[model samples]
Target chain A: MASNSDQQSMDVNYIARLARMNLDALEARQFQTQMDGIVDYVRQLSELDVEGVEPTAHAAPIQNVFREDLAQPGLTQEQALANAPAQSGGQFIVPKIVE
Target chain B: MSAARYEAVIGLEVHVQLKTRSKMFCGCATSFGAEPNTNVCPVCLGYPGTMPVMNREAIRLTVLSGLMLGCRINPRSKFDRKSYFYPDMPKNYQITQYDQPLCLGGGVEIEGASGLATVPLTRIHLEEDVAKNMHFATCSGVDFNRAGSPLMEIVSEPAMHTPEQAVAYLQGLKQTLMYAGVSDCNLEEGNMRCDVNVSLRPVGATALGTKAELKNLNSFKSVLLALRAEIGRQEQLLREGGRVVQETRRWDVEAGATFLMRTKEDAHDYRYFPEPDLMPVVLSEQQIAEWARGLPETPRQRRARFASEYSLPEYDARVLAADKAVGDYFEAAARGSKAPKIVSNWVMTEMLRRLGETGQEIAAVQITPAALAELVELTEAGAINSNTARELFGELFANGGSPRALVEARGLAQVSDSGALQALVDQAIRENAKSAEDFRGGKAVALKFLTGQVMRLSRGKANPQLAAQLLEERLKK
Candidate 1:
């Protein structure tokens, strides 16, 4: 599934910024080559002539899965904030955001 | 500067909370005004490894709304995750329809300045509501009670040109959703919220200008005012040789001005991906047809039918059919009465006035439709006069009672008996001999004066027509 050597290069730093993550220069360079290899491997599927095939969103053939509208009891205030790293006055506290 | 030289292009995105018992993906009560964070569950709280199950009722209601708005319900639809970083959204990504929406291409007919105009709709999609963020002085609080609630986003095309048309379009949409029983559409409770997009262009221009999105327009009035302020701001900028930047503005309701919130560059790139937990919704033609057939008559259809079936004027039908409760009350009363116009008059003038004064809903009125019908019938039968009916309506509105029973108990029955009214008439003629002589002398005003005296003597119970007849008969002698 290896791609030709002349394929377009991937920009890992740009993609990392979009995902709101920071990566050093060395890591970005290493991830760029690895991501290129993964993309090339996945691109091999384009060789097949499956023109009439339907695009599937899920792997399993399932539809119309739903739940009833009846309400059940949920978490209390204490339990809801149990996993919070910081808390104040029965609320989860985080860094202040000003806009 | 001539305001007429510029045309405003406007579109609206409305979010209506579906009236479901539970949240969209979990078994948590969707009731508003509950204690903060009480409705939070594992799935809604975005806890790791918790999967969401679609609420069937929410999907049904979304389809119901789509049908009411005349939208084409996509037979195959699926959900996608819209990624964003907002504190109110517990998941940091809202599960909504992106490329494939549930409904597409509908129009709402509004009474525009020129006449009836149809506001074209772009799409209607289903999404999960986020938690409410309440800002305070020192810190902000979050209420997860509204989190994960079912919300439908109805996006309109840039068809509205004026603030008035936008308001009309919103009102028409609200009426249709309410009639469909899919949502309460209460703005005060935050069940319905709007986002407006406004742009300006030269009059008769072919291309559209850059648009600024308006936020925090909770009420219809705010939507109108915000659009007006934004349009003015844009026009002023253009006239000053400055360009209008595409940004989001917040409407300062108190200051009556719009302030810049964020620019297009700051817009979040909602990296969307198909939701894997929930299965795709594949509806059959038979199912869609069945749902469409079972839908109630839309507000517009009801308005038209009210005009033709009840023989009411367009104005009367419009006002009556604007609200479902009012329309139902009018129909119930009209069905009982022979004269539908009489019923319309009572409802439009008297009933609506009382409703406004007491701040009562039509369904909560003390006077039932049957009672009102009975009152109208009594007035038409000459059992009670118009003045007496008005008084009775006031009493009935204050305290519930049957019009017939009240009339009988209060002794308000009109005195149509010639014997009783003739006695009263003879006494009035004797007491007002000068006026009787004046009447015989061909002064028509004197006859009215004599009848006033007879009515006063009879305690207003005298049948006016019979009293006039008896007075003329006595005058001839």
Candidate 2:
């Protein structure tokens, strides 16, 4: 399993970039090997035949769980911004976004 | 090719914030302009391990809007996670209906230069709006009060050829949504925002040209102006042997031109997947039927009904049917009145003007429809002259009361009795003998002077027509 037989390598660099992660070259190489091993382990599902089965997002067979559209009191401005790393005038401040 | 040979093709994607009392997935108030971040909840704030519970009212209103626009309702719709790294979105990914939106095929019927046409719709999907980001000098502030509000994205097909049709289409969509009571659709208040994609192709070309997306067009005027400028720029570019590039341009309202909004970013690859926490919405036929029963008349249908039921002209019907509240007001005021045209005129002119000047909504006005109807009836029946009726109308519009009662209390009724009118006319002839002499000497202007005297003697209560008739009898002698 460590030697990796005829399977193509996973693009771990692209995946990390999509996740907004900064990986050093060594870390990228290491993650490629580990993620390939993980993918190989997950590929065991290919052995099963799922052609006729209906694709499902939820396995519990439960649907239409909704709450009434009634407003209950939420966090006050003080409580809401309490967790922010930065705050200004009861709002969370960040770097300017765009023009 | 001449500039006229190229036709502009435009399509709009409008985002409307649904008018619900609570957030889409949480029980936070959706009221606008509360203290910043006051409406925040764990679910909308994207706290870890928080699960979203769907708002049944948001779903109902979305389906109702679809029905009002003649869309086919999908029985089963699921939410998908769309990834965006923007800070405006508290969650890294947006929960939107991708392949299974609640509503499928509908069209907005717009009245254009060719009379009436339906701009075909691609789809309408329900999604959650993001937070409000206010950019300051050095830092941007994020307010989560707007997060998780149910927002509807209505995508129109690239079927419009001109900017006029595009504006009409957007107006029609907004009117229908407002009529359904789904969203307020107020452009100025950011209740509705639009993005348009435009391209120009030479006449008789089958394939489309490179399209440019125009953004930040908040108002209908901006939509029209931005589309025009984009179309003009593209046409001029193509005619001058340049190619139209595909990019995103934003409308600079100050400059009245479109400028490149952003540098081309990396290719968007939103790794969309099914949302696992919330379950799919499965509506039964009976449930959809119950909602369909509550669908209000669309703007087009309401306009047609106003024309037929009230016998209003086309222009009046169109103006009256523009707003559902105004149309409701007009209908209630003209329900049993014999003079609907007169009522329509007053509603269109006086009522709308006052509401506009005072920045008030039709529903918040002091005047009641019954009072307006009574006022119109009084003026029509000659119980009060037109001038007196108008004066009383302002009084009634400002201070709500019975028009008849107000007229009686103020002694403003017209003096149409023959005996009282004859006495007033005789007094006018005797006092203004010079004017009477001029009238007998074949001066028609002097006769008008005598009528004014009669009106003044009765304190503007004399019926001018009857007073003129009685004066003619006396002055002839």
TM-score of chain B of each: 0.93, 0.89
Candidate 1: clashing residue pairs, number: 0
Candidate 1 CAPRI grade = acceptable
The B-chain TM-score of model 2 reads 0.89
Which regions of candidate 1 deviate over 4 angstroms?
A1-17, A22-50, A86-91, A95-97, B1-4, B423-457, B471-477
Best by DockQ: 2
| Pairs that collide, model 2 | none
Q: Candidate 1 lDDT, tens digit per residue, B351-468? A: 9998998889999888999999999999999999777899999999999899999999989998889988888998999998899999988898888888889889988888888888
- My TM-score estimates for the predictions, one after another, are 0.90, 0.88
In candidate 2 chain B, where is summed lDDT lowest over 10 consecutive residues? B261-270
User: All models, DockQ values?
Assistant: 0.42, 0.47
> Across the candidates, what are chain A's individual TM-scores?
0.83, 0.85
Which run of 10 residues does model 1 chain B get worst, by summed lDDT?
A: B134-143
